[model samples]
Target: MAFRAYGEVQQRTAGPKEIELSLFRQITEALEAVAAVETPPLEAWADALYRNQQLWTIVATDLVNPDNTLPEETKRNLVSLSQFVRQCSNRVLAGNDGIADLIDINKSIIAGLSGIPVSTVTEEAA
Candidate 1:
């Protein structure tokens, strides 16, 4: 299909950063969409959560890899953030309304990936 062809082209052309940003944007949107509905279907919520967790797991793995180029402090922060995401995801899965934090965290990472300063993102949100 044309759509599949386009996706393949995009995948080949996108740089690592762009690919990461796109993925975060997609997963974040999925979570936000499910959160917006009252009494969202459990299956839908779980699917979104699983995607998010998988994304974070990949990120955490890369952060710990010896070849990762990020500074130590940045890696530490990301690992901690990943841990928090995992805990929050567990709470959400247990019938708690704790998805907002996950969404916000993803938005922050997206902003960073998009080259927006952290202060600017927080100011705009506030």
Candidate 2:
């Protein structure tokens, strides 16, 4: 009951962008946690990667929607990024250790959504 109430309150209070940022943060955290495990169980790794892939896929789809308000260039860039995410995830699932790049991408997106300049986030990461 308490959990349901909290969720209702949160939904009412958080705007769309805030909710998107929060979801990205949560999915990124899951990916990070799995990556931190030195030899994470296959199931755990797959679950994290799957979640991130799903998130990006949804974002890409939404970007192309006719009702989406984003500029064409921005939508194209994001859709391209989402494609990269999907390809990288495929590589990772095929035994390549490429999860770090995906995590960094998610972090960059989170930073952008949080109103921080992406270049600043990239420089900080470097």
Cα lDDT tens digits for candidate 2, 79-117: 999999999999998887569899889889999899998
Q: Which 10 successive residues of model 1 have the least lDDT summed?
A: 117-126
Q: 29-77 in candidate 1: lDDT tens per residue?
A: 8998898898888888889999999999999999999999999999999
TM-score of each: 0.91, 0.89
Question: Could you tell me which 10 consecutive residues in candidate 2 have the lowest summed lDDT?
Answer: 117-126
